[model samples]
Target: MMIGSSNKRLMSDINVTPFVDVMLVLLIIFMVTAPMMVQGVNVSLPETTAQPLPSEKEHLIVTIDQKGQVHISNYPVAMESLRHKLSKILEGRSDREVYLRADKKIPYGNVVKVMAEIKAAGVEKLGMVTVPIDETPADR
Candidate 1:
């Protein structure tokens, strides 16, 4: 008795359907999560459609507490040294921006002082952060 062999082609093609499906899923996920992604200090931003701020990039955070305490990146810095520190931070980053976050109760003078220091550091565009007023009790 002899056995007969039949010719059957082996599938040699790669299936790209799974790859496409995965990419589509990733795209949807990113789209859904894009709005939820917040990229900076979580301050109750002050209102005023003063135009939106530039998206997070390397930035210098200068905080002036209500008591007139000055902080640079959360580190307590002397008023005299603020300029030097800012200069160092902006050393390689000539394009870097400085964002000032001060307490609402902070005196205008204090805020101005911080801005002055930032300007002295040679940074032209200094952005300030504030909390927007809320009418809703829940927000309050």
Candidate 2:
């Protein structure tokens, strides 16, 4: 028997177990964080049966919390200056549309007041964001 001709064969197969484990870990991390990535002021939206609007472009969002505090995107804006802030923000944008999300617990008058201010800001279109009514029998 030749000394250099042993029966051991070189292992050519790639070990994919570690790669699969890493991928699974990344998948789990994304799954856990996906919902939280949609960051916004937390508010309980009222349910509506209206059809969802089709959005062609990103629109500025105005939010009102349960305490009736107004916010542009995530930043708080005073009611006294809401119109001014909106005017300046919309001056350069052609869409001039703003979506309002107000807590259902807030009084309707507060929502109307916010809407009035939004209109005063020269916004051409104002959309109300609402949760769709659940049609599932289990929910009823």
| C-alpha TM-score for every candidate | 0.57, 0.68
lDDT tens per residue, model 2, 12-114: 9999999999999999999999998777797888888998888687889999998899999889999999999999999999788999999999999999999
* Model 2 CA deviation exceeding 4 Å by range: 1-38, 135-140
Off by over 4 Å in 1: 1-54, 135-140
lDDT of 1 by residue, 8-88 (tens): 899899999999999999999999999766433333334544554558576678877666677777677898899999899
- Which 10-residue window of candidate 1 scores lowest in summed lDDT? 38-47
Residue 82, candidate 2: how far off, in angstroms? 0.3
Clash number for each model: 7, 0
TM-score of 1: 0.57
Best by lDDT: 2
Model 2 TM-score on a 0 to 1 scale: 0.68
lDDT of each: 0.75, 0.91
Clashes of 1: 7
